[model samples]
Target: MQIPEFSKEQSALLARFLAEQKDALSLAQTHGYLFAVICAPEPLDVHQWLEQVVPGCDGQMDEQVLFAFMALYQQISEHVFETGYSLPVSLQFNSAQQPYLDMQECQHWSQGFMLGAQGYIAKLLAAPQLASELKEALETAQQSLCFFILDSADIASIANQHGLTEGLLCQQQYEVMNEFAAGFAELIEAVAVNSQLYNDEGWG
Candidate 1:
């Protein structure tokens, strides 16, 4: 699937709107969470999912901004479902402008991802057919996601105590984010396998 690129101007516009609305997740994180949700075995309606993840979206944005937002979402959905990996939007940020991942923003992004996964998690957890290793991986990912929920000041303090620099902290965060993405991808693969089996044998 060909992913559409949003120009810098368009991104700035969307960022402005999200800022004005005091949205918890940044535009990039919003896209990331939406991508994960779309890659799930049982995906929700796009419009409904967007409405839940981004409240007041329809009412607050002008048509152009709204269209751009949906276009980005579609691009992310296509990339995740087709390739089983998230688009590397996180890498686009430069260390100069934003030296490190803000703890608060990371928390918001994790919260959004957790919210998006709520519908599918119960079924995933209850599936007796899932392998033990995969289940453990999923559980570990859940715990990692929760780590971001800690207070930014406290996290910073802990990092300072450990003598971690901004660059080192950013690298650690990326590693964790990569692990989370890999875990989700594994779960999605499991879902696909189960879905195929059910379709073949009518046993879902």
Candidate 2:
């Protein structure tokens, strides 16, 4: 199914706003951050998550920019809640007439996702109801997403630690990206089910 997205003009404006802020996440990173916030097992207050993206969360930011940013978050949250597996946009480039993933943007997005989801992940790890198999899958998914964020030195260290070659890791990049997305979707479903069961018990 086709997904709704911010228009180029809106994106341009957001980018400008991000550029002006000190230590603020880029547009791509903001998208990833918001996605993680939406999929978190427990809901994070909108103001809380907004502070992560912009840092201040008061009346300092321009009204128009803040409005656009909040609108972007709302759209992404609605999409995830409505259609379970929809991913926010990522960068792609044409190389030799074939499309290739933009690793830099992916790195920023992955970093932002981790930053936003760290609290939820810690809770998930300790939750007794989380099955062993699902926990393992979550680990694999986290590793897959981490690949994009790791530097060459770190990648080499990991490869050597695992007794694997850098060439092998490079060859598996695309496959790992697919795995990351699928695993994230699975995580969302699992957490949603857990939340629902918790709510039902509370009501009962």
Q: Which candidate should be chosen as best, given lDDT against the real structure?
A: 2
Give one digit per residue, the lDDT tens place, for model 1 in 1-204: 443575667778877776777544567567657765775665667567667656756545587777777776776665555655542535435656654554555666666677777556656666777777766766677666555666767667767988997457655766787667755655656754653433443336
Which runs of model 2 end up more than 4 angstroms from their true locations?
A: 1-5, 83-95, 156-175, 182-186, 189-204
* C-alpha root-mean-square deviation, each candidate: 4.7, 4.4
**RMSD from true fold, candidate 1:** 4.7
Predicted structure 1: lDDT: 0.63
Q: Which stretches of candidate 1 lie over 4 Å from their true place?
A: 1-4, 22-29, 56-61, 81-99, 152-170, 191-204
What lDDT would each prediction earn against the true structure?
Answer: 0.63, 0.68
**Candidate 2's C-alpha lDDT?**
0.68
Clashing residue pairs in candidate 1 (N, C-alpha, C atoms within 3 angstroms)? none
Tell me the tens digit of each residue's lDDT in model 2 across 23-108.
88998788778877777655577678778888875546676676677678777766665654444443354665544556667677
Superposition TM-score, candidate 1 onto the true structure: 0.69
lDDT of 2 at 173: 64
How many residue-pair clashes does candidate 2 contain?
Answer: 0
